[model samples]
Target chain A: MTTGAYPSQSTARLTRERFRAGECRPTAGIAPGMTQTNLIALPRDWAWDFLLYAQRNPQACPVLEVTDPGDWHTGLAEGADLRTDLPRYRVWRDGVLAEEINDASACWEVHPDLVTFLIGCSFTFENALLEAGIEVRHITDNTNVPMYRTHLPCHPAGRLQGEVVVSMRPLPAAHIARASTITARYPGVHGAPIHVGDPKALGIVDLDRPDFGDPVRIEPGEIPVFWACGVTPQVAVMASNVPFALTHAPGHMFITDVPDSRYHV
Target chain B: MTTGAYPSQSTARLTRERFRAGECRPTAGIAPGMTQTNLIALPRDWAWDFLLYAQRNPQACPVLEVTDPGDWHTGLAEGADLRTDLPRYRVWRDGVLAEEINDASACWEVHPDLVTFLIGCSFTFENALLEAGIEVRHITDNTNVPMYRTHLPCHPAGRLQGEVVVSMRPLPAAHIARASTITARYPGVHGAPIHVGDPKALGIVDLDRPDFGDPVRIEPGEIPVFWACGVTPQVAVMASNVPFALTHAPGHMFITDVPDSRYHV
Candidate 1:
């Protein structure tokens, strides 16, 4: 829908309308200052475990809000219906990819015990990094931020457990400290960089080939920095082998009324 | 057994020793610089709702760590037993004050399904405030910090729901901004003053008579500042009328290996 091209207060509403009308697309750079979230829906029985998992590993899965069982609305975005507001959704059956859908309302109706979780996305903090005059390679290159699976294991909660996943950004060595300081303020998002320098430290052999998303160019003086990715929970949830689950497609986030400034210290 | 008189690295260990020996006393000023926590033990069944409630209200109930069902040890403090480390514990029966004891191990043994929650206490931030050269009135008076029930209702989760409870500190008008900034750095420990002036704004009437803790003197030109108190969860748990629950007694806290600086931004 290219809602980012028309940045305004109405961007969130317009983007949501397009998603409601079956237009599936990435949500990056849309609605400028507004916060966007990663969505995960699970049965009420597994919701507690997932909630605890988020609490135990907040940096990878910073939960903005969790809806009550069978509820689809979030207070972060007034009047926004979670069931069909996001551009696209991925449904999983027994930890395997089952279907890709424009809206999750049908799946949710079948799983009446569903609980929706709104998790903070790195896009919010990336906006802050841009405002701080730090260049974000992906946005400049018009591609999704490169992400990789890390050797770091997340603290397990109930049946949910998996390796941590991180998103990468490359910036000049001189700007690393400032970039960290700027992003650290938005803990609601992914917060500070988890690793800087050697990608091998996190077990990533090649920066050009990412586990998820697209790789961006690393200039001569630039160093790759990594932040915990919201995808960590999706991987963990899939590994748990739950009977069914619903999640926002990679880069297709649910826009909220909350502003990026709301997360700043 | 008054460990407050012995402020040293060994204070936490010595305090735990005293607690093990059945010396029940308040924990205020016992282990300076060491992070202290509020304890809440609930049945595994009710633990999910309480954990969700804490997640929904991080300022009031900043969860440092939550134990797996029937486990008493926490990573926050090595070798520290949640059942017996705190100098005193309060047992609630059907939402009413049942008994105050030296240790909760007995009640825990009887319940078999208890899940312990270690929640961050304001004492960590209070230590930062003192280091910032701000005077904490109750500490100066060698009394418990004055806490009051407020009109602000916490976001309810399942059976847990109640008004927010705040701890009051009267600081000079000029220091309010500095105090807010200092405390804001410690989001793990309540973080910043929720109310700066006008106690009546939070439905706090009669500053001299707080609903919890002792009243502290407020000199002229000083304004009453309020921070979300750990007591908020205790109040909510009580109102929910859980059959049995255990909490650290007012002013008695669980000493952890974590330092106040760990929470700093």
Candidate 2:
């Protein structure tokens, strides 16, 4: 969140400083090595089914740390505060965008009952992939990873239901297997590639177009490897249209105390 | 389920037969090489919170599969009749013990009903650990694994509340690292050892005294390695005593079609 002097603030230190100061912004590359999680805050009534849906779909909706209902901060992620820790949060009420806020501390009063769900994001694995000589197209190209709505239906739990969302990476076929083996180690974060070759197999009709995030190039000889995207639970939330919901923006992530490697299975 | 000629029927074939005959029995050693899951059935009203509890406590509760409310069978596990697959069922009414039944077909009714939760057991990983020359105490002692109620509390979901239950395995120091590395792969089942040495750290007063199952010896240099157990959920069920709850008896698992190796990470 620090402008030109960003290097002066470490990822963990900076995240805390920015979040505590109420400076809300996208935290994509804010913390280089620290694990950044996806935020999905739902009403107490809807928390269980959402949790079950995530359980049913681990490859996509890997949970990092979940808080007890009515508890704002879970002790798992160091001193990170769930209510105002993230840069920004989007509020969805009845499937409609209601308000975007720097923090939800004010909103918590409406329901002492709101539950927090911090899910593992692909960003954790993508950071790992980059360090291992793999060129993450979106990061290299300075755009969000291309995410699509797949035809594959998630095994429904209770009333929460939706299609699977996948983030694609165009890497060599050889790297697909290696990537699968590497990322699969971190089941806490969305681990491993769910689909390796075909986009259409996931009901994706076009390569250049995506349902979420920006599209990147698929260089020749590079096979498109798809990993379960964090957007999965969001889609379920939208479909359910519960009276109220809150999630971090597209690139913004909730920074955690956990290191990337430790999240491995 | 058949008293005569338990042989002549392969584990796979036998699973199908018992399922067809509406026989619900403990599926501990049945179906060699295949995975067996723990079942936790709750009312539609309590489904979400419990599912969330499972998500937060996956190591103690690996959700291998789940069924929508009112649905009895988990299509993932080859026509598994949740109502009558396991040999017996423990019914809980308002967090109190209602009764233990041989079959739940008579108890089951339409809508506002059963949500089957298939949790992973340690059987699959024990097979792998054994193959690797590690000693799984209960297996050697010819009895059920020693499970103890821990002082450590789980991240609760809604009305679902409880303590963490752990299964013990005594191993030498050298095997601890290898054991940790190997078992860490099966996140769908309880992953690696949550505790390597100190039992008191988990609020366990006496190693000889356990809340469930029998205790085994910790030879000189042989130490206890604990993995979160599925019994953790039952503790919550016992604490809440939600009316009309069902779960597999301790060690009596619900056999599944999925292979054990498939669950690695």
Candidate 3:
């Protein structure tokens, strides 16, 4: 199920209930003031390694909440069921994409000891940048933010190892400092731009050709600023060939009841 | 072995080597410019719960580094051995204090899969406070900072649950805001004071008698300011009756090669 637009007035709980009822859509605009989280679930054995990986690479994988083994409930959202709450779920088997479905309840039967991780999403800070009168090109163009895999390797933890993946947003050179100051307040999300000007510095060859998401236009005086992407954890899962895993489909995030302000320092 | 005073000109490596060679003394004044960490080690099975506990109660237990299971190495201090690079350690069995030792190497044989966590200490921020021209009473008096076991229960994570423990410093009312703003910059360490005045609000009965450490004088116009303390995780271990655990003895912290400025925002 897909909706052209979700009601902006809807609360996070109501929005999650809609997703649970199979209303599949990206959660960016829904529950505007609430926090949206990226979800990943791994079996108990691999959970420790993944958690350590997140700890080591916090810029790319700022953790919001981690649920207990076999538990689907998260403290971030009251009365929400992780098994069927999100708009869509990706099921991975031995590191390869096995299936993309609207409901993940059946997948839990195969691996009952799955531990869920809710990670901070950049959408929270994008709101702050917009409030500070900084233009977010991807939001203006109504396209997914361009993300690329970089040569910069993430700190290895336990059995997990992967290179960094970053999301790019073109901003006017004048607004770069203001954008950095605003986003730095939200470290729970990917905080501040890692690289402000050159794409080659991060080993990216072209801004037009992104490994993930849609590319947006770069204005005459604008520079491409890159922030560590949440997808870096997904890359680690794939590169490490995790035996079994589940994650929210790209853009189809889990809207938590917690407000965006809670993450603001 | 005990020394009257460690030379202030020494580097963290030299200080750690001295501690490793059995120099029994408090670490606060030993490593003048480097970071000193509170250490805790737990068996593999209990590590997850304790990590979750710290995540849930970050104010009281800000985590600096977590070592891999059965790994004695920490990224915070290169070439520092977790088993012997501390002035002292406390070995606990079934939640009871079993032995206090200068070396933890012998105890590791029993729980070989132990995971070590290096936690942020108040001493890091206390230095900042002093630099900001705020008086640190305990340091001036040459006494341990007064700590109280509060009725404020930490948000429970997994099987680990405990009350919040706070370190009190009597400061002039005017310095409270500046102190908060200063410490808030160092989120890696315990960021800001949780309570500024009225000990009774935290269920703390008396200002003169603290549960741990020595009492300090509260001047006429000065008020008691309580910040979350590093002793919290140890309190959790005691409250949860953890089967096997090892922690640095109070004040006998593990000096790390990392500079305290690295913890400053």
Against the true structure, whose DockQ is highest? 1
Give the clashing pairs for model 1: none
Per candidate, the number of residue pairs that clash is 0, 17, 0
Off by over 4 Å in 1: A1-8, B1-9
Best by lDDT: 1
Scored by Cα lDDT, where does model 2 land? 0.76
lDDT of each: 0.85, 0.76, 0.83
lDDT of 3 by residue, A1-265 (tens): 1222334325777888888898987665556657788899999998888877887787888888888889999887778999999999988887788899999998779889989999888877777787788888877877777889999999898888998988888989899999998887777887778888989989999899998778779999999999888878778878888888899877678887777777776
True contacts kept of each: 0.35, 0.74, 0.13
Ranking the candidates on DockQ from highest down gives 1, 2, 3
- Poorest 10 consecutive residues by lDDT, candidate 3 chain A: A1-10
Candidate scoring better on lDDT of 2 and 3: 3
Stretches > 4 Å off in candidate 3: A1-10, B1-10, B29-33
Query: Which residue runs does candidate 2 get wrong by more than 4 Å?
Result: A1-10, A16-26, A67-85, A93-113, A217-220, A237-244, B1-10, B13-28, B93-99, B109-112, B135-137, B172-174, B198-209, B217-221, B240-244
Model 2 chain B weakest lDDT span, ten residues long: B1-10
DockQ of 3: 0.45
TM-score for candidate 1 (chain B): 0.94
